[model samples]
Structure formats: structure tokens, C-alpha cells
Target: MNSNIDLKELWAKQETGIPDTKDLVKRVASFKRAHLKQVIYANILLLLVAVFIVLVWYYFQPEYITTKSGIVLIILAILAYLFSYNQSIPLLLKSSYEMSSADYLQQLLSLKRKQQFLEGIMTNLYFILLSTGLFLYMIEYTMRMKLPLGIFCYGITAGWIAFNWFYIKPKTIRKQREKIDGLINKFHLLTEQLTEKK
Candidate 1:
């Protein structure tokens, strides 16, 4: 029964060739499984570090850090870590798309622009986040007014730099967004082709 379904024949036709119903279902399921495996492997070390954090907090926190401040510090650390890592989920998922379509080498080559476009969006999002963080940090610092004038000025300057990086980082945002937009169009084409094949 499996021998009857030819993936190449289905993929090539652009009409009625991209495998039978069952095969397509199986292929999508396989793709999802592969994606999950990649996510797990990609974060294996991160998972270990998280495990280590819990173990350390449980076993070796010193007397100085035993108070509420220590627990607050731990929570902040985990939140910061999660926020940064979550940003890369798409890129992580995308590694598969890199090697997923082996036979479609030319098509694969064509996906560079899409990849670049996605990256730009992601980068822009990162900058926006950073700028926001800096703005809040500045607010907190100014509210306290406890630091020396030099340190206060430095914090504001860093915030300005972060704002620039978010919106005006030379070359990166423009290039990445444009490239990914182009790729999105190509992906639309691919989806259309797949639909036609079906």
C-alpha cells in the first residue's frame, strides 16, 4: 500500500501528484515529529541549566540570599532567561525547513530570502523589546534618584542606544525585513503549488 504512493510523483505534478491523502497526512505528522525533536535537542543544555538552578537554590543558597530578596532574584532570573529564549522559537523550528526538503534543492535555495525576512522580523521584535526594557529601567533609575549623576546619565545613554538598535540599527532591520517579506511570498507560492498538486 505504501509503495503505491509516490511522493516525488505527487510533488512534481503541480496537480494531483503530491501523494495520496494518507501519505500527505503521514508526511505532515512526520514533519511535526521532527520539529518537536529539534526543539528538545536544541534546548537540552538549557534544560540542564534550569535543572541546575533549581538544584542549587534548593541545596546551596547562602545565608545572605536566604531572604525574600533571593527568591525575587531567582524569579527575575528565570523570567529574563525565558523571555530571551522564547524569541528564537521560529528560528529553531526553521532549522528543519533547511534540511527538510532534500530533493527540492533548488526550491530550498530559493528560501533564503524568506529566511532572511523572518530573521529581520525577529530582530526588529528583539530591538523593540530591548528599547522597552531600557525605557523602563530608566524610569526606575530616575525614580529612585539614588545613583550618582554620572551613573544616571550613563543609564539614559544606554537606553538611547538600545532604542536606536531596536529601530535604527544600520543595515540589519531593513535587510532582514525585506528579505523575509520576499520569502513569505515564495512560501505562498509553494503553498499554492501544493494545493494545486492536491
Candidate 2:
């Protein structure tokens, strides 16, 4: 109704301190870098654990073939987890800081979906593999031990595994999803702000 208003002139005079799209993208890039570093550290730790397991198997050389197979399974699971994790980090790091708001939002959403999949399906698979591998490896050793000792060992092992699968994993997944969802919402809001008329 205000035909006399010069919209373009008003827009040109708009405040400069509003959230800059490039700055948002830079923030996202920094987040990705931090996440990548965590991933690298976690993968390295996993590799070290795998190496330790292999060393134990090599030096001990349990008489049962099942024990050897269990060790192999554990190694395979670790390698699989590493490969899956490495695939995502490079993709995440590829998001350009100069990307437009809409493009960056799309990237963020895609990354969120990928993260959910990783946290849900891949995580479950990894834990399952670990639990099974450990069970198989422990079977021969447990059988040779006295009944009370075997019960105590298996009880502690089962308790720890249960705690991880039921509590730690779900809590971790929830936190991860919350973080990514928060980022996604932030990007959406930023995009809206960028697109809004002054």
C-alpha cells in the first residue's frame, strides 16, 4: 500500500551486522573439521585395539580355531568401521565455504542424514560384530577356567557389553542426532534470514 516507499533503497541501507551467509558456512566448515579430527582419533584408537587383539592372538595362539576366527572377525569389524567412517569425513570436508545459502543448507541436510545412518545402522552393526567376536574369542578361554572364575568373567563382560549397547550407544546416538538436528535447524533459519526481504 506504500507505493512511495523505495524498497531497493531501504534494502541497500539495511544493517550490516546481520548473520553473514559466508560466516555461517565458515562455522559449519569449522564444525566439520572438529568432527573429522574426532573421527580420526577414534579410528586410530580402534586400529590400536585391533592391533593389540591380533598381538594377543598371535602370541597366545589358542589351540582352538574358533579363537583365531574370532580374532579375524574382530579385525574385519574394525576395518569395516574405519572404512565407513573415513568415507563420510572426506565428503563432509568438501563443503565449500563460498557455497550459497540454499546449497549449503542442502549440504547440511544431506550430511545430517548420513550421520543418522552412521549412528543408527552402522553403529549397531559395529557393536554386534564386536560382541559376537568377543564372545567367540572368550569361549575357549572361559571353558578352560574354573566355574566360579568363568561366571565372574562372563558376568563382567556381559555387563559391560550390555551397558554399552543399551545405555551408552543410545545416548550417544541421541546426542549426535540432537547436535546435527540443531545445526540443520540453524542452517534453515540462516537461509530464511538470508532470503528475507529487508
Candidate 3:
């Protein structure tokens, strides 16, 4: 009886360190808002780029079929990427502050899976299409240039693409994964705490 009382007192004295549900909900809502904003910004930028490319194609009107094909491939890559990227928007929109912890966790997991797919397969496809398109697109312009200039152009473009593929893309993916993983871990902890309390 004395040990039981001591245990109860110790338990009572211990700090829960658990965050308030309201605050957790607010943080989650903020995350959702930030994510949605990022999506919107990315979509707008990609669309603008696509429009710019189309405008250039219209105004320049290169004689070579390779140039036309390159332009089409680039546009197709952008559109395909946009379509695949937007697939996550609906999942994001489905999440809400009012959701139970378990539900929210499930939603986040789903979003993470979607992100993985985007980062892996879709990204690979986009880069492949873009690289091929760029090479094809440069053919016509480079042919008109002096040999040294044409070689320089190809070298610079290849270097840029390689940098993006090898460095920038991996860095971006790591950052994104860390952010989502942190959020998921927080929610997992919150769910466990809530469950224990019940």
C-alpha cells in the first residue's frame, strides 16, 4: 500500500511534457498551409515557363524538324511533371485540423508515399525528357554557330543539367524528406500520447 502511494506520487510529480492538442493542431494547420502555398507557387512557375517556351516556339519558328520536336518534348515534359506533381494536392487538401490523430497520421503517410513517387519516377522521367529535348533543341542553333561556340554551348548546357541532376535534385529531395519525416514523427508521438492518456 505504501509503495503504491509512492508510485502514484512519483507519477503525479513527473512532467508530462506533452504539448497541448490545440497547439499541435495549429502547427499541423500551418504545415498544411505552407505546403499548399509551395504547391501553388511551383505550379504557377511551371505554367509560366511553359507559356514562355510556347511563345518562343511561335516567334522563332525554326526550320528544322528537330527544333520543333525538341520544343514539343520540352513542353510535354513540363506538362507531364505538372500533372504528376498535382496528384498530391488533393491528398493535402483532404487533411484538416479537425481530424483525429490516427487519421492525420494516415493522411501524412499517404502524402509521404506520393512524394516518394514524385521524387523518384516522375523526377527521373522529367529530367530524361528535358535533357533529350534540350540537346535536340540546340542542334539547329548550334549548327549555325562556329565550331568553338557550338561546343562551348553544348558543354555549358550539359554541365548545368548534370549539376542539377547530381547535386541540386538530391539536396532538394533530402530536405523535403527531412521535413515530412519530422512532421510525421511529431504526429506519431502525439498519437501515442493521446492513446496512452485514454
Candidate 4:
């Protein structure tokens, strides 16, 4: 009984390392701003690339229905991705300062779910559309070129696309999930510490 009391006293005196509410709020706000900027930059870059691809199709005019259909599908895919991205950004960037800790936590969880859905389902769809589009687009182009040159071009494009889809994209998604989960945990701990009796 005496040891238990001493342990309690010791724990009470220990610095928990959890920042005060205001500091935590500030930190979270800062993270939100940075994250929002990254999202916006990525979206804008992708939108520009999509436009560039469409422009190329309009000007160069690949000589097959498949090529035209491919370009259209690629445009559709990018637009769909952009729409989903825009919808989720507002949910993620809404200020949490005015919210109670519980509400804020709930918001974070919802944002995480939305992110997972986007990264998992939407990302896969985007890549599928991209691959199929490129394949269809290449059909006519490949026929006009020398056999060796055509093989080389197809081989390089396929390799690069495979590398991005199988490696880089999944790695990026995993890192994002980890970062969000870490933030959620930190906020959870901070809230618990703040609410606990000394």
C-alpha cells in the first residue's frame, strides 16, 4: 500500500511530454496547412499533365478509333480522380481548432477513412485506366514504326509503368497512412493526458 502511494506520487511528478492543448492545436494546424498545400500542388500538377495529354491527342491525332477512345478514357479517369480529390480535401483541411477533442478525433478518423478509400480504390482505378489507355493509344503508333524500335518503346513504357504501379505508388500510400495514424495517436494521447486527474 505504501509502495503504491509512492509510485503514484512519482508518476504524478513525471513530465508526460504531452504539450499543452494550445501548443498541440498549433502543431496540428501547421500539419494541416502543409498537408493541404501538398494535396493542392499534386492536384494541380496532375490536372496540367492530363490537359497536356489531351492537347497532344488533339494536335497529333493518332490514327485509330482505339487511340481516340483511349485518350478519352484517360481524360475521364483524371477528371474522376480530380473530382474525388477535391471532395476529400475540404474534409481534411477544415480547421479543427474550434472543435472539442472528441470531435476533432472523430474528424481525423473520418479523414483517414476517406484517404484510405481514395488511395486504395481510386488509385487502382486510375492506374488501370492509364494502362489500358496507353495500350490502346500505342496500337496504331506501334504499327507505323520499325519492329525493333516499336519493341523498344513498348518495353520501356511497360517497365516504367510497372515500376510505378507495383513499387512507388504503394510505398507512397503506406507512408501516408503511417503519417496520418501517427498524428491520430499523438492527438489521442494528448487529449487523454489533458483530461486525466493529477
152 Cα displacement, candidate 2 (Å): 1.8
Question: lDDT for each of the candidates?
Answer: 0.56, 0.82, 0.82, 0.80
Ranking by TM-score: 2, 3, 4, 1
Among all windows of 10 consecutive residues in model 4, the one with the lowest summed lDDT is 86-95
Candidate 3 C-alpha lDDT tens digits along 1-198: 999999999999978677889998999999989988988998999989989988988999888999888888898889878877787566566667688767777677677667666656767788778988988999999999999999999999999989988997778767867876787687678678767788
- Distance from true position, residue 74, model 3, in Å? 1.6
The C-alpha RMSD in Å for every predicted model, in order, reads: 12.0, 5.8, 6.2, 6.7
User: Quick one: best lDDT, which candidate?
Assistant: 3
What does candidate 2's lDDT look like per residue over 1-198, in tens digits? 475467767877877667878999999999878987898798989999999998998899898877888798888889878877787667666777788767887777777678667757766777888888887888899999999999999999999989988998888778877887887788778777767855
Candidate 3 has an lDDT of 0.82
Query: What lDDT would candidate 2 get against the real structure?
Result: 0.82
Give stretches of model 4 more than 4 Å off.
1-44, 95-99, 187-198
Candidate 2 deviant stretches above 4 angstroms: 1-40, 97-99, 191-198
Listed in order, each prediction's TM-score against the native is: 0.34, 0.71, 0.67, 0.66
Which numbered prediction scores highest in TM-score against the true structure? 2
Clashing pairs in 3: none
Report lDDT (Cα) of residue 143, candidate 2. 94
